[model samples]
Target chain A: MGKNKKITDYDMEQLIGQVLRYGVLTSGIIAIIGGVWYLIQSGAGFPNYTSFSGEPARYTSLTGIIKGLTEGSAKEIIQLGVVILIATPILRIVFSLFSFILEKDRLYIVITLIVLLIILFSMFGGLKV
Target chain B: MNILLFTLILLLGAYLAGLAGSLTGLGGGVVIIPLLTLGFHVDIRYAIGAALVASIATSSGSASAYVKEGITNVRLGMFLEIATTAGAVIGAILAIYTPVNLVAILFGVMLIFSAAMTLRKKHEDALQEGSKLSYVLKLNGSYPTKEGEISYKLKNIGGGFSIMTIAGVLSGLLGIGSGALKVLAMDTAMRVPFRVSTTTSNFMVGVTAAASAVVYLQRGYIDPGIAFPVIIGVLAGAFTGSKLLMRINVKSLKVIFSIAITLIALNMIYNGINHKF
Candidate 1:
């Protein structure tokens, strides 16, 4: 049983590692593309980061990001990459939940569920002020 | 400054932050915050948002390698995430209402704590009996060494969880990984093996950061212009630094870097007190 559990753990770890690596690579590429496009469009514009005005509505929410992406907005594209990067870890948690269930590890499944719920709450539970 | 030049310079700074962060084992988001606020004259909120994004990137990137090594205890990491994710939500919301100067001062203090952590030596505790909670949660795990697989048992689960909550709050508030605090909880408090604690902490940092990042994103704090350069530069720098790790004398480098970070942290505290932000 110990040997079998070790094998299962190893496989799961490998899969999780692959997920993280691919997620990062894909997001990095998308961000670079958006950044290059942005530079070409507004590279010579005077930059202003000194002020504290928050991001516009179009760049803040998930729907807004998707809408901006459909409209081919470079900044929104970059934001899409950022969104994907953030989701990568959450996806790992979701993956862990399924693996725990497969192992019939009830304790871990509950623990993973709690963590996932918290993350989901942060994402979709209107954490906006 | 034009957008091109600003972006270029930010890229260079972030790359160096990542390089130095990985080399020194301090993590990049810590330095990224000060660089943006003090050097680039960016707003503290925006700086934090960008640093959080970069934190997620670096954690996931490095955790991939560590996870494959089989030293990272995934179940243990998930259990601790319960505390960290909750604390992150609270901290992210708190950052919204907290004054920028106060936040800066807090970040400076955290920087000093992190520097002190880096200078401290790591000692692995001898194997101890596992607590009932650890056994029930199946948190005991082993890692492979040249000799064979060495198993370790966890102690003081409650204490470690409590410390992890604090680490999570700091991560959310300051947009740093707070690896120092996480290590203290797992390595010092719980007496987990140093290798396992460090790798597990790496695994958890991404999820903890992601919890706060959602709030930051909804609040319109994550600017693509800032996050883009930071993410790309820090990832590239971390990759390079990992490759360079085998060739360099990291102990001396860590000492030098920690001192530099201490000086920078003092400057941040002074600026915050003066309301320079």
Candidate 2:
């Protein structure tokens, strides 16, 4: 509504862009580090992916991933990188929600909330197949 | 092959897949799946999981650039994301229950459809007046052009939102970005400007993919070994390809890539029929 508010909106958009760029760059670096460590530590083993067997329990959940990281498992480190990548967009949504709140735009605040909630449900709702 | 050899080869293949994906605007996931399944003999489920990670990388990476350019309508993207995220959750669940063979068949079909879309000429239909619903939602926005700023109005919010749901389902089930379908929903159904439709679709894809990716991760499908090389390779390739896009004549390149993708799709169909997956 005011000139000051408009400047904040532009600043928020720039901030969102910065978040995406940095999030992706940071995650890529982590994944690469884990990958290099894995290759160096156990490069001789052969990989057999001809069939579908799900990942081990340790690599499947968020808590398990963090636990593996503390134990110095390279694969879990890579998974942690992936967790960061997935989190990037969710963070973007969080920033957008904040911007909407700043603008006092009730409709977009509600719309952004719906989108964020759906994503949260997919992450934590534990709907089994 | 040993893990070192395998990882190296996969890295190379994924780079090309990402390069060709961004160059053709068809996305890396489409080619990444077939390359993993038919070429490396990897299981389709693993392929899908790796592809999903690559999709998230490319979408988020590029969205950073597009958002700064100010062409992306964040508000419009957020509004449509309500449908997409819900649909993605449903599609990810369906993928878990569906037969692998059927999933391969559907993925092949989607690849063919995507190739066709790339070959078709785009028609920008920016409307002059916003619909009553669009007005209330404040969906109308302006973008910068050569001639100062040009504003556009939106129409058929319901129809566009419906198509976006389908796009989300395809993205979730197949582990693809499904940008073509999202563009169609906005550009054709919603009558958004082509520039806005594309940039906004790019902006929305990361979130949409993230929605389903969470489900995939919980089901233990995201193998870190496969995902590491794929993500690194695709992100690098896409970054290079986007830079090249400004200099190269992409018209001819698109035709060639589409043909190549079509052949790969047909092969996937054959393999699915024979239960070779």
Candidate 3:
């Protein structure tokens, strides 16, 4: 019974657009943070670029820089991979779901759900061959 | 090589690639492969894995919007996917066993071909309807052009299907979106109107990517450290690009992109041939 705001302000497309932008930005931020974290945690020596893979190079090389970043305890790296594996897809599916809702179309929703289920089961079902 | 840092560099690389690829209309995967393998010295296999994830993100984020706008022919996309996915699965298997050198050489050749093709005449400006298969499949559809809705039918269903199969294989083998090949199949071989073919191709790319992505993930080739950044960055960039598409001349940009891809592919070939361990 009071003053009414314009309906245009609450448009669904605007909301969807916000979600799209936010989701993408957040994911990018996470990726950058993860990369930096890996570098500091690895504590590998500063690298040199000259030497290719061999027994060992005496001096720091360019590969050494990248190697320093890559050579970490397997457990820690694997753990990070697992976390990202779960996080990335879930975000994607969530965004995609929102899109389906925005469109108000039921066309591929079932198929998407089933495809997602397969991916989830395959990833986490713990069925090792 | 710490895992986290590897992920970080890959994220940066992908972000750079996405922004650049969008500006150039080359597609993210094309730029990412060279950046990872040549610029950062990442293993080619891992680079391809990351590229595959990025390709899906790029297509999914951008193409979904097009679908919402009702420009994409979803039915056409679904129908063609059966052939593409089958081709993708076979191609993925081949990628795992094919010698790295062969992959490199093939990639190089493709890059050259794509560059030349891009420089060729713009087919959208010259539309010719020829084949009967397009009519049988109802590949003909109308799209919103500036002048209004323009309806066009397909001409060559068989030829188009064959091209889709090849596109799927290339996508699986190289972790690319394979949009160039897809467009060529529809625009040149099938004579489907340009807009319809491109959007439909975009619609199907996600399916193609998923088919091969599953295989790659199972093979342990998909490192999350690499995939996460790529997926995120590319999705964001592609989303932005889709919005800009209505305002830009994507065709002109595509020519430049093709050239860049050629150079990147050449670099990959050189590296693969030289990296004899």
Q: Candidates' TM-scores?
A: 0.98, 0.97, 0.70
RMSD of each: 1.2, 1.4, 8.7
CAPRI class assigned to model 2 = high
Clashing pairs in 2: none
Q: For each candidate, what is chain B's TM-score?
A: 0.97, 0.97, 0.88
Q: Could you tell me which 10 consecutive residues in candidate 3 chain B have the lowest summed lDDT?
A: B122-131
lDDT of 2 by residue, B1-277 (tens): 7888888988998888777777776677887898889988999989988888888887887778778878888899999999889889989988968888888998888888888888776656567898999999889988888878888899999999999999999899999989889888888788898789878987888899999999888887899889899888988887887788779998998888888888998999898989988
User: Per-residue lDDT tens digits of candidate 1, residues A1-129?
Assistant: 878877888999999999998998888999999999988888455756888888998898878989998999999999999989999999999889889988888888889999999998988787788
Q: After superposition, how far is residue A38 of candidate 1 from its true place, in Å?
A: 0.1
Interface root-mean-square deviation, candidate 2 = 1.0
What's the lDDT for residue B227 in model 1?
A: 87
Model 1 clash pairs are none
Q: Candidate 1, which segments miss by more than 4 Å at Cα?
A: none
Write model 1 residue lDDT over B1-277, tens digit each, in one string: 7888888999998898878876776778888888888888999999999889878877887777778889898989999999999989889878878889999999999989988998887756546688898898898888898889888898899999999999988888888888899999988888889878878988898999999999998898899999899889988887777678769888888888888888989999999999999
Error of 2 at B254 (Å): 1.1
Q: Provide DockQ values for all models, in the order shown.
A: 0.88, 0.82, 0.09
Q: What is the per-residue lDDT of model 3 for residues A1-129, given as tens digits with 9 covering 90 to 100? A: 111211221243344334434444455555445545645554555332222222122111223323533665332333233233323434444454555554543554544454455445434443211
